[model samples]
Target: MELLSLDKLAARMTPGSLIAIPADYSGVSMAATRALVASGVRGLRIICVPTSGIQADVLIGAGCLAELETSAVTLGELGLAPRFTAAAKAGSLTIRDTTCPAVHAALQASEKGIPFIPLRGLIGTDILRQRADWKLAENPFADGADPIVYLPAIKPDVALFHATKADRDGNVWIGRRRELATMAHAAVRSLVTVEEIVDVSLLADETLAAGVLPGLYVEAVAEAPRGAWPLGLQDLYPTDDAELARYAEAARTEAGFRAWLDRFLDGRSAAA
Candidate 1:
């Protein structure tokens, strides 16, 4: 397995990649989102449930990519807006997967290197028919019930995440409610942003391990301090609402976003 330092991970991601981000309203993966936006990537489809993680909110605030809302609204309803009503009017698409299980199912098909997976419990539902992106079918394992929707696999060029501690080799200890591992499994390649890289010895102890994101699957690691905000640390830190307000204010206006970028996000501060 190849091990890349922060610089390497920062270097590999470019503007052309399509990405998957945490679909929750908390522990928002800011580094991963910012890095992709900085590169000029085409678009990103964030996952969101009714009111959690608002990952979509922060992303939209940044003027980065179009949004993919998995709520009650259809893609047509959202109008392809990332953070803007105008962008959506420009033709953004939305689907009503509405649950993590369904979302993961689609990604699983991609991770397994298959074209599509047969799922159940969504047949004749609004999500299956109205959302052209999703292909719904019956589950072979079940006899009679709602059919399943084939969620697509996500092959991100890079996976940037914040960890409590990971070793230099890339074995990750992502505690609390983690969607990173689930994402890492489906991505084509990945990266980790850690608060600390611990000794290789500690990784073996089971108590320190609720879940481990194996290093072999990761190509790079970035040592980031205060990396996840508006998104909390597993147990150490809480989401910073003030910081979020700062971001929201900046993104509310184009002039504000550009000015904020020049002062904070564009140069040395961005990398920090």
Candidate 2:
């Protein structure tokens, strides 16, 4: 079990690495994202589990993303993800547009150590047409009439996220968001940030055991209270609506976005 500083954990990632993050509502490691930005990390291929909001937007604004693979990037009720939308519109980043299920299926295939996973939907759609990597095949079980779509396994170089709690042994309690577990299984390494670290083993109790992501799959853990700021953490805190609104408005233009980034970086430095 390894417990490191947020910047140290971020240092473990290489430039242009394929990194996976949890969905918007899920606990996101915003502290780690800030740390990465502070460290001037660049060329990351960020893979949002299905969709993202502030986390993706911040990285995109910082010029850290070389590519983004996700279904959508929206700030939920806050509105559209400004930096993400701008980047897409400006053609600044490579986007591997995919559907929700297709992203999930790819991660699932990686978790199960499979080369590809067949999905039922996405036939005769623009989503299927855009992805030449996806292959169409005849179902061997049937009379070779039915067709299936196969998605390549999405084995990310790192899976980064935040959790409500972590034990001294490094096990993280993710509760019912089991997609995090699948991400850990699919990624080469899993880096996690938590609000707190408890002394007792999370797996020692039966009830807690069910929700615990075993430390065996985790590479490093960092303590980051209110880490999912600007976004919500389940049962912990609500989204920082005021800050998100400010970000959305400022990020509408490149100049305004740069000003926002300067303010954010200054605040982060001051806090540090």
Candidate 3:
């Protein structure tokens, strides 16, 4: 398979495409997302993680775009700040209560060209109750009382990933995490932004190479270092409480929010 270039990746990736972003909080990923927002595109489906959730608040508070919050938060909890309670009041944003596994299941269902698939274990839990979207019906084939989850096809139109390293051809080693491969198999298109683009042979040291999202799955790749800044560098980039607090205060009022957005969310941090 041929490797991809960043230009090719950007050209094919536009707004209105569903995406399952990595939970990793790479500064570069945020920049890429901000760029997408600036392009006037909408509709984003983020794979929930603590960091991704925070970034969502930043983007949402800035009024850059809108989203269906599906991670840890709930529908009624929309008004309840991320820093606050369990349930939202009525509506701030629609919550699509599916967890990250739903991300894999959806993509897998789509890739296989099936209408839906039964999830092995995610049943009879809070996820089921919180997710008003989940369809409930008797198992057509089974005689027992256990119900099945008919997860629909979830191939994101395009996917973006930041890898620890990549080759000029776009083959990457994205750490030990396996989300990228799951996303690639499920999506029609994929893009990878890596810290460096080097020779594919240099990838021998990666113990998790089997989990690598192959070059064929990648539609485009860019050599972008320090991309995971505000987000992280693996174990690095711990949560910045100050930034989050400032954001809550800034978004408390519309005028203050606008100013805060222009000053910081315009791509800079609270200190920047």
Candidate 4:
């Protein structure tokens, strides 16, 4: 895997690409998201593995997204993601409302190289009705009329996230966050940002190997310390609660969002 600059890494993400991103609690590449906004790339279709937060909102507010498929987009205790809520109401973004189970099933289908995966959780939900692509089928093996929702495979063009570290061999250490590995496996390729890079081989250690996403699926890597800032790396740092609160307030209006974004682009650190 090639080690690249953050901007150069963002440059590799072309317009109209389908990208899979993990939830806020997982490793989120906010640094790369900022670079993506700065580059002014457009027509991105995001697949939030299950849910999203400011990362998706920032892209939506910047008009970089063409479509978004997710269960929800909220700023946790801060409440609804302002930009996402605004875009949805204005009908500026195409939203494909899905559930956590459905999204995981779809990606798992891709991972298994299958056309579609069946899910029972969505069988009686409005999400099933709204998704035209999701089909309803009767179980042939069942004794009675048992119905299920068929979620089509979602093979994203790229999977992006941040991590605590990468070893010389490019194996990313994700701890117990196996969903990130699932994302990389389901996507065509993966781009990663890390806090640090060490000379040791992560895979050589049996304990470390269990939590590592092997470099085979990684297309590129970039060193970006505090890459998940405002957000947080698991156990490395805490989420910047003050910054998130500020963003939640500022992003409520167009002018306020633009001003906040300007400061962000200028590399002015947020008061945390």
Best by TM-score: 4
Candidate 4 Cα outliers beyond 4 Å, as residue runs: none
Ranking by lDDT: 4, 2, 3, 1
In order, candidate lDDTs are 0.56, 0.88, 0.57, 0.92
TM-score of every prediction relative to native: 0.73, 0.95, 0.73, 0.98
C-alpha RMSD by candidate, in order: 5.3, 2.1, 4.9, 1.1
lDDT of 1 by residue, 1-272 (tens): 34455455655655344455553332445555556456555455554422233345444545555445455221222223224443445454332345556666666776788877666576667656676777766566676765556766555555556677778667877665456776677777777777777767435878765577777677777766666654677676886655445545554556665654554444233224
Worst 10 residues of 2 by lDDT: 263-272
Best by lDDT: 4
Clashes of each: 22, 0, 12, 0
lDDT measured at residue 149 in model 2 versus the true structure, 0 to 100: 94
